[model samples]
Target: MTTLKKDSLLKGTLILALAALVARMLGMFQKIPLDYILDAEGQYAFLAANNIYLLLLVIATAGFPSAISKMVSERMETGRYEEAKRIYKASLVFGAVSGLLLSSLLYFLAPMYATDVVKKESITLAVQAIAPALILFPIIAMMRGYFQGRQMMSAGGISQIVEQFARVIIGLGLGILFLSLGYSDTVSAAAVTFGSVFGSIAAFAVMVYYARKLKKQDARLAVHSSAEARAALQPNLPYATNSSMKLKFRAIYSEILKMSIPALITSMTINLVYMFDTSFFISITEQVYTDERATEAFAALGTKAQSLAGIPPILAIALGSSIIPIVAAAFARKDQAEVNKQTSMVLKIVCLTGVPVALFLTASAYSVTGMLFASPTGYETVAMLCAGTILQITMMTSNSILYGMGKQKQTMVNTIIGLIGKIVFSTLCGYYFGVAGFIIGSTICFLIVTLLNLRLIKRDVTLHVMGKKWIPYLGAVVVSAAACWGAEYVMLNITEGIAEKLSYLLTVLVSGSILCAIYGILLLKLNIITAQDVEALPGKLRGPMRKVMRVLRAGQSG
Candidate 1:
């Protein structure tokens, strides 16, 4: 295959971020229907099973994909195409075997885990239903990493959309059908969980189709290589000769394990915190409240509050994933200037997006939570969680930078330290304060990790955060927060004629839009986003943004 131009950081981030936003929207829509279908107890069960599924899935695949991506990119940088191909092939085998084995373990152990460990026998079906998806996800992850390593995000992004779309459609359909048929809540939840399996299958199909097409393209290019060069760079020579492929596999696997184990641990840090909550939050609450109340509290915190809070960080996650390969390539070339530039750009974008989102969501937390979930019970928790989004975005971006800079072990250490803190804080606070305690604990944990990461970045790269550079973003946040709060207050006072739910919806929608406009204007007026920044926008947006910037600039000059 012809080597494509390396994707610029802005273009790559925008591509993945847009895809992530779409996927996140679909996910949010799915949750609305799910919350409607599953009562508090059922939602608790669903989240219980899902938390375990995610934790296991992260353990099985997270590290290898990242490791493969980094390794492949590093090799490709040196024009060692054959080595990169070998790494890809080896990772595919490893992913398939590990996925199958771990999936089997989960499927069989679901009963014990639900009944014995989590003390929730009702989640057995849900856990078992999601087990099959585990088998497909790792393989899919490997393919995504392959494309991401090549700095081609289209395949991965498209597959994510296809996956989430299929999951929502099939999962929701099955769930509704089961409920309509008068099935038990457990059975209905199980049916919904099966959606993950279908989604993974659909995603796998897309990735495979793309993989085969790319393989053929690469094969045609391979024919052009000279015979001597081909012989010297035989990636699959062991298969052709008397040498055992097992030995080659062993070597590749060892190298992958060395590189990936730390990443795996680092990746698991967030999920580990979730699992900690899943294990402790309800159990601790049960000591002070009835089982039913405990379950309701867990559902509110895990399902409603955490889910709503997660939306803002979708961009950060995408930005994090996209930067790994870009930064890695720059580091490979010893391009310190490019590394610093990319790092600074990513931080600015994260703060610009994340700060406003955190502020607006926190300001309008009750309305947003009520509008989305039909209840504002967890509004305070959601507000606190939303307040933590800035830290989450910063932590994710910094972690990715460290991972790309070949500091995976250091990142892992930082995550471990943070995870330990989370466990300690969550355990103590959850036992004492229930849902509010968990939110506070989580927010504090994120702060700890983000601060650690920032310190490390400064020490390693001599990266400086100038107050002048961030003042505009902070100003924008202040302005947006004030606007949203004012709009929300006005809507509350004037919308007495409207239905309560309708009023909440209107308050959020109207206030959110006004807040966005105000934020954008403040950003321009403060000169936070320059003409050059507008030029870097996607082709369709650039022209309009440029015109707006021109008018704004003219006004300033006049």
Candidate 2:
């Protein structure tokens, strides 16, 4: 990969990462108010509606973003800039129309899922309340796809921050207002969920603002292009008097769907598993526990634990989003070396940033949960689910690689296998082992998909992701987990007599440090992070990290 592309990937990843970080933190905070104000029953209604909407939203939007990104990036790379813009327009039109159709579907099906599945009609209102967001969000998603394709990530990042801020602020305030007015949990849920509509509006405004600016920039760049370059893009078609070439929009739409259907399946399958975890819980657990008890437990396991579990995978998602354009461009050029180089770097980067956070969350799950929630259930479940996200990251990264390479059918098949495995395991495990078993079952399937993808990648394009460092990499993960767990255990014993929130808060804050430090030491000692990896880091981070590396190596040598 060229230095410029590498730098673009890092910049894009960092921008998206920071956006995800803030959004996730706000999401976590949003949960706190939901927990305290709305209580367990309210949480169930909100999450049920929200989770169902997410599954459908994935169905609505997933097909377009990566497809558009891949198409746009490839076209832009070859300087077929007009073709790229047409792809965006095609996607935006399809997405807007589909978003509206699906929004209506969700609105109509609200009662079916709410009453039949969730056993609460109030959730129907909740489901319908946020449905309109789908109308505009799909368009926003296409805009993000276009920006990412152009390697202009800050637009998407800014939109995410703005969208999430709107959701959290409006969602929580409305919930509080409804509750204070003696409204039923039903009214509160719908009120809170309406925040999504506001968020969508905010995101739409932001994307539009960026889109206009990008158009101006592109127009400026296009003035310098020669007629020869424009003619080359479409050798069969005559260039216009202004050196512009026309594209067949129908063919472009066909190409997009061919790419997007599989892309949709591959990208949204993991989230399907996530949604299934919540959706299947009531029916499965109702057999073992009472309906009311099961509802409360769902809030604990499904809402609380799952929300916290979601934090670490943001890096994987951001990195995956950032890499698709780069990988797609390389694949288009038939640059196998660059593809492999990029594939290796993405996996390695996932390990560097994602692993330690997963381990820390796993080790300190109880402490973290204790600090956040008054409920005593789901403490161990949180740890297991958080650890499970490591597997989730592996699957996500590998799946994105296949998606970017346009291995559409293979990626689709492998991801569906994983999703089916999740459903089957979740049922059997939830039947026998109870609430936490759902996470375990889903995680086990993620591993199956991860291994399958590794095999496929090797068969197709031979990227030995960890290469010979598999042992040390595995060793680093194991050692970091052990150290964090041990330190948290010791901290727990020391802080046992204090308040639940304060004691666990202390344990989490302190033991989390041990996890990071131990992981850092292992990275230096085991050479798991190569010199090239350091050089690939963004400029602002690279200098500080080099200084740290030198100091650590000097101490080790002494």
Candidate 3:
């Protein structure tokens, strides 16, 4: 690709990444009030049902979009533009039909699925509440994937924002309105689920607008082509003579299912860890705590604790998504040096970003949870989850890197081992410490997986990611922890009410930022990110950094 083209591509990807980050921020803020608005049990029911819906969406749409995009891009690369257009059109229709069928089946079977397979009585009501949303969600996922495949990320970004915004506005607002009128939490949870359906509908509308625009563009392009060209580009019309349309649909179904299986396995293996943990944690906690207050706290802890520990995982997703394509392309070209450099740099950035955040959370778990949740019922849970966040970030990045390097089977094995470890440890911990055990189990699993990935990296990739680099990371953690603790103490003395809450949050944020700056400088002082590294940021940022010496000179004269 030309430099300009590559730059444009990078810019688009960066924009999408930023959009995802902002959307996540919005999602968290949206959930914060919802958690308060509905209370623990209500939030649990809503999240529980939504989790099932998410799993189904991932399964149904896992590899279809990526595979579709890859196919289209490959066709375009080979100069078969008309054929690519035909493939895109076929994929769109296929996605819509399949999404509809899948959603219908799941929506109808939701109660049975929850009661029989999940075996949760509480989940039954929530599942029924979320059923319609599940039904409509697949179509939205497909549209999202289709756009992503077409490299039209802006449409996907807008759709995501629109979807989440609708969920927050309609779900939270209506639920709060109902609560003010004396609706029970259970009913509010149900309303929240219904809101999800409306949110998906809104996203679908936005997607249709973009899809139609794409269709217009495609039609304009088609007008320039000869009739013979269009005719030649069409597939053999698939089963011309006696074959029914059902056969064609079935063929499309089979194709999507075949590709989706691996992608499903890959996606599920990654997500199942959390889903099973969710069930296991809730079950184990209910067993340990017969008291209603304790049980409620246990259930709520899962949300608040997970929320507290979620920052690293959120940031890791961004790093992982960016790194995967880069690593995949490098592997494709057999460019070992570039692969090694990119992998190492990405890993460092991940650690540099995650460690301090995790440390800050660990140091101020109680204050952080109190600030967000208006209660300290699960402070211990928050701390344990905070530790897990660190392990999760490390393992996710390393395992993702391995997967990108074409070690899918090894990555699968690592996940299986981690899952097994999580189940056993979580069970034991729950027996010993109740709900807190769930977070402990999570931390244990990620630690196991991180070690496994390290072994793989050493044996297969010749990288030393575990020595001096880790030592510095530890130092940064210590620095961040001290900073947060000190900040917490000082902020607590000078603030009250909303200002106190804001002050505590600002302290945490500032503490984390300072630690990152110190970590980066320490790395440079220790020759990690050196003079050359400063020059490698995006052009816009690099220009400002390059003028630092001039600014320093002017400052000295002043």
Alpha-carbon local distance difference test for all models: 0.77, 0.77, 0.65
Worst 10 residues of 2 by lDDT: 233-242
Candidate number with greatest TM-score = 1
Candidate order, TM-score descending: 1, 2, 3
What is the C-alpha lDDT profile of model 2 across 107-206, one tens digit per residue? Answer: 8987887778656666778888988888987788788877777777788788888988898799878988999999988679788888988988998899
How big is the positional error of residue 538 in model 1, measured in Å on the Cα after superposition?
6.0
* Number of the candidate with higher lDDT, 1 or 3: 1
Score residue 470 of candidate 3 by CA lDDT. 64
- Screening candidate 2 with a backbone cut-off below 3 angstroms (N, C-alpha, C), the clashing residue pairs are none
- Candidate 3 per-residue lDDT, tens place, 1-558, comes to 101011245655665567666655655565567657776667766767666655664553345655665555565555555555555566667756666676577667767765565445555666676666655565666666656655666776677677777876887777777788898887777776667777778878998888777666456436665656544443211111222222254554565555555445555643565576555554566567664654366555646765666676777877776777788889899898888787777776677668767777777776677678766567777777777787788887886688678776676677778888888988888777887676677678888888988788766565644346566656655765776677666665655445656766765566556656665555544444444555656688777655653454455569
Q: Write the per-residue lDDT of candidate 1 for residues 1-558, one digit (tens) a residue.
A: 343333555776666677667766776566676777888767877787667655654553467666677777786666566677777888788779878997899889988887776777788888899988989787888888787787666777788788888988998899899999999777898898788899889989999988887676556446666655544443322212222233377787888789888888887766777788876665666666677788777777777777877777877888787788788899899998878878877887787777778888899998988888867887887788788777877888888899889888888888888888887777787777877777767777778888888888776464634347576677778878988999998997788698888989889988999899999888888888877667766699999988888888889889
